[model samples]
Target: AIFSVGVSQLNASLAHRIPAREENILPTFRKALDLAREDADRLCHWISQDVSEDDFINWVTGSVRRMWGKKGNREVQAQFESDEGRRSVFDMLINLAGYSMKTKDILKQCDRVVEGAVLMRSLLKKVSHN
Candidate 1:
């Protein structure tokens, strides 16, 4: 719940900082932002359910892959693969960790979460920059 709220706040901040001129943004970047918002909502929904660790890990991995697919070009893909991108994704997981003490099962999949975060960071960076 806390993690989802943080994600929402981050996304809102990004949306607000970007120019209102939609024409200046890449079509794929816009789609990535939309997908990210949807994912945050889904994460909230999932948190309320009695989901297994495996299921949660799958969702994390799949969502990251979906976001990566939204990369518009080589430049965007490269950005996703950059150090900043990796850091952002890991930071999200760190935030999640703070809220997971009550649900220790989720923490059991830390390795998987880290894998997904590596890919997710790129999508986050791409969306943030453009």
Candidate 2:
């Protein structure tokens, strides 16, 4: 109860910062996180109405990294320990919020599935001919 609220408040607070400098992998990661986060909020809209995938991912990712004694944040790594120390990290993705395999890969997979089905059917035809 209290913990949940504390985490929520932390996310709400972080949301405003929206790092502008852009990390190297932010494009794909941010997009996936945003989508996943949106879906999560939509899922939770009825129950207290204040949860997002972004929040969950950040919380989990940040917490896990902190626990491992390895921040894993690029910003933290780069600065070593300066004012910009926070900027080095790529947002943690514990929630696994968004992005499912790339589109091109998915299409190729679908194509393979179709090919497999066709091959199976052809195998049946050969068996019948024999």
TM-score of 1: 0.22
- The lowest-lDDT stretch of 10 consecutive residues in candidate 1 is 71-80
- Candidate 2: residue pairs that collide: 37-53, 74-88, 75-88, 75-89
Q: Which lDDT tens digits does candidate 2 get at residues 52-127?
A: 3343334334532443235333332223233322221122111111111223587755654554344334333333
Residue 76's lDDT within candidate 1 is 31
**Poorly placed runs, candidate 1 (over 4 Å):** 1-25, 50-130
User: What do the candidate models score in CA lDDT, each in turn?
Assistant: 0.46, 0.37
| Candidate 1 per-residue C-alpha lDDT over 1-130 given as tens digits, one digit per residue, 9 for 90 to 100 | 3333444545565587576465544553565567678887876653333323343344345554453343322323333344332233344444434433333576545744564456445444443443
Query: How many Å off is the CA of 120 in candidate 1?
Result: 22
Candidate 1, number of clashes? 1
